[model samples]
Each structure stands twice: as structure tokens, then as C-alpha cells.
Target: MSDTGLHPGLVRPRPQRRRARSRTYSATVRTLGPLALLVLWWAASATGLLTPDVLASPAEVLRAIGELWGNGQLPDALTTSLTRSALGLLIGLAAGLVLGITTGFTRLGDELLDSSIQTLRTIPFLSLVPLFMVWFGINETAKILLIAVATTFPMYVSTSSGVRSTDPELIEAMRSFGMGRLALVREVVLPGALPSLLAGLRLSMTLSVIALIAAEEINATAGIGYLMSQAQSYARTDILAVCILVYGLLGLTADVVVRLLERLLMPWRTPQGATR
Candidate 1:
């Protein structure tokens, strides 16, 4: 009875069925790429096209993981690396939040601080290793500071942009209703900036892992990087591969944590399909 001689009920069901099929197809394709690569890697390794020295086979990497876990090296290294990363991330986030709010919310603060911070962020954090070593020595302080520095800029940029993106008319309306500065920021500015802040946190966490690798290389005695150094000295490619995999896992874990936080903090933004 509908236009084009098709029933309304039948047409609606067709589109829904098409969407379901499309979703299934997309999910399958997403996983297939990684599975295909894994199979190719295994085939190459089995055929002797990829040697252990050049790259450890997937099985050898698994065995190395078991060996490290059984011997307790992996646990201790994970704890140490995680501790340093946590401390640095906390410090960096706090500093970034303060700096971002000050500059993004106030004209005077922006004029005084934004340019300097922007210039500093442009310099590669790794290049400051020598200076950090000289200033703080090759101790825990230097390593933690290195990660802190690496993580700070992402939060700063994200926070600033988010805060600035807030609707000025809404802010004015709040002001007309007698909202104080602190109240305005707490209710309006911070909420508006939250998505950007979460994004920054995700980026900062990833950088913290990357910076951890570099920081641990500075004469570290007991961390994943130290294990990597020892593996390099002994030509244990399996161990090296294990360390690389661990780093990747850590990054993935950090991303998952941020996603969970997003879901918790921004329930309204959750996808409709996901809620179902």
C-alpha cells in the first residue's frame, strides 16, 4: 500500500536486516586482517623464511613469556615500570590540568603562559634526556620526570582546546544567574572540556608507556627496558619480542581504561547499539 508498491512493514524489516548484516560483515573484516597477518607470520616462521635471530616465532615468544613469568622476572619488571608510569602520569595530569585551566579560562594567564608552554612542547622530550640526567641524575627521579614531561603536553593541548570550545552564550547565561568564578568553572567549563580531557588522558597514558621505554634505558637495573637490554646483550630475540609485546599490551590496557572512563563519565554519549 506504500509508494512504489512496497509494503511499509516489509521495507522497514529489510533495512534492519541489511544493517545487521553490514555490522556483522564489518566486525568480521576487522578481525580478519589481524588473523591473516598472524597466519602469514606463522607460515613464514615454519618455512625458515623468518629466522629466530631476525624475529622470534610466535610460539617461541609464547615460551619466552612463560619462562619470564615462571622465573618472576616479568612480574617484578611490570610492577616497577607500572609504578614509575603511574607516578609520572599523576604528576603530569595535575600539572597539565592546572596549566590548561589557567590559560584557557583567563586572558592574562593565556598571555603569560601559553606561548612558553607551546614552545616547550614542540621540542622532542627524548632530546632532554641528557639534561634530565645531569639535573636529576640517572635515578628514579630522572626517569619519572621524563615520562611526566612526555605526558604533559597532550593534556595541556586537549584541555585548552576543550575549554575554549565551550559555548560563550551558556557561560553568559550562567553569569547572569549569579554564578561565581569557581562555580562557573566547576559546572560549565570543566564539563564542557571533559571529552577533550579524557582524550588527552588516553594520549598521555600511551606516551607514558613510550617514555617509560626510553627512561628505563638510562642505566636502569630492573624494568622491562633493563630486560630488553640484557636480552640484546645475549642475543635473545625471543625475550626481546616478549618485551615488545608487553609494551604493546600495556598501551592497549591504558586505552581500554580510558574507554571505560569515557563510558562511566559520559553515559549520554554511548552508542545506541552498544546500549542494546
Candidate 2:
């Protein structure tokens, strides 16, 4: 043996090797699994095992994509979808983060908001859509409101619970050190709550995207959701499938952005997972 003791380079190399191995496995599994499914789907459609009336083949969807692309409808619809979803998500994140922190940190706030939140959470998300429409009209306001409301609760619950579950010993130590209220929150509580808050935010974003799509689909003049709805009227399943694919892609893109942000915001989080 060249060296019995662990060298500085050797110590780090083990972890680097393990990480690379893990990534290789993860990538292979994810890609191969999806590829297998796609092959099956393509085969089934080609063999007429699946009805084209109900399920468009990938080729058909691609052809429809070309048409949509040529018409310049795809870009316009995508822009509208992104804009509405982003706006709604921004509003919801702000409201939910503030409320969640206040309620989680204070007894008085918990007493005031808990019961109301509990009751409201039980109501179906879809049920609120019509109410939003009536209250705000069938305009961008209604769509945005619908998405924002859908996004709020998940974030509130996650952030509040994360705060509540923070290690009391750490909190006590901070208090013993004479940390002020704002500093305690800014330095301790918020950071402790961040992992959970991120989880809630991720959920909210996915939900908001869905809610916005529903809002647009029900009645709207623009957006991918509108295109999907319009296609259904004409029995254009290929275009409908294309819209669904776009929704999936957009959702994936949004989640990836959030994951990157989480990594930046919580560098302390290990590869193992978020602590909470």
C-alpha cells in the first residue's frame, strides 16, 4: 500500500466517486424508464392497439406541432400561459409566506387563522373556480385570482409547520444569546422554515399552473390551455395532445427552476435531502 493513512485528496475522492456513481445510476434509470414507456406507446399506437381517435400517435402530435409552429400560434399561446402562471404564483408566494410565518410563530395568529384555514382547506379547489369567475368576471383578473388562491394554502401549511417543528433547543440557545424578535426570525426561524417553505412553494407552483390551465380552458381567447380547449371542440386530438405535452414541459421547467433556487438558497442542504 502506498499510504495507509487517508490523504486529503483521497478523503475527498471517495465522496466524489460515490457522487458520480450515484448520478450515473440516477440518470440511466430515469432516461431508460421513460424511453421504454415511449417505445411501448409508439409500438401500441403503430399496431392499432390504441385508438387514434382517443390517443394520437407521437408522429401525429409532431405533425400537429409543425402546423401550430408554422401558424405562429404556439409562441403566442406559450407566452400567455407563462405570463399568467408567473403573475399568479408571485402573488400567492408573497401572501402565503407572510401569513404562514405570522401564524406559525404566534399563538394569537394561530388562534385567529387556524380554524378558518382548516375549514377553507376542505373546500374543493375546483369549487372555488366558478366563485372566482362570478366575483372577478371571465377576464385575466379571474384567471389570476384562481391560480393565486390555489397556490396559497400549500405554502402556508408547509412554512408554518416547518417553523413550528424547528429544533427548540436551537431556538432556546438563540434566545439565551439575547437575539431580538426580528433577528431571531430573520436569522433562525426563517432559515429553519426554508426547507419546508420551499416544499410548499413547489407544490403551490404546480397547482397554480394547473389552475391557470383550467381557467383558460373553461373559457379564454389565448394560451395553450385555450388551444387545447378549442382543439377538443373540433375533435383535434393531436393538437390536444400537443398542448398536454407543452403543459408537462412547462411544469418540468418551472420545477427545475425551483430546485435550482432551493439549492442556491439552502446550500446547507445535503445530497441526502432537506432536513425537514
Q: Write the per-residue lDDT of candidate 2 for residues 1-276, one digit (tens) a residue.
A: 227566545642443223234656665866897699889989999999988898999899899999999999999999998899989888988888888888888889899997898688777778877788778888899888778888888888998899899888998899999998789889999888888988998899889878877778547999998898789999999999999889988888779877888879987666552221
> What is the TM-score (0 to 1) of candidate 1?
0.88
Give all TM-scores, in the order shown. 0.88, 0.85
Which candidate wins on TM-score? 1
- The lDDT for every candidate, in the order shown, is 0.92, 0.84
lDDT of 1 by residue, 1-276 (tens): 887687767754343332333556656876898789889989999999999989999999899999999999999999999999999999999889889988999999999999999999999999999999999999999999999999999999999999889899999999999999899999999999999999999999999999999999889999999999999999999999999989988998999899889989998794445422
Q: Which residue pairs show collisions in model 1?
A: none
**Lowest summed lDDT over 10 consecutive residues: which window, candidate 2?**
12-21
Which 10 successive residues of model 1 have the least lDDT summed? Answer: 12-21
User: Model 1 segments beyond 4 Å from truth?
Assistant: 1-30, 270-276
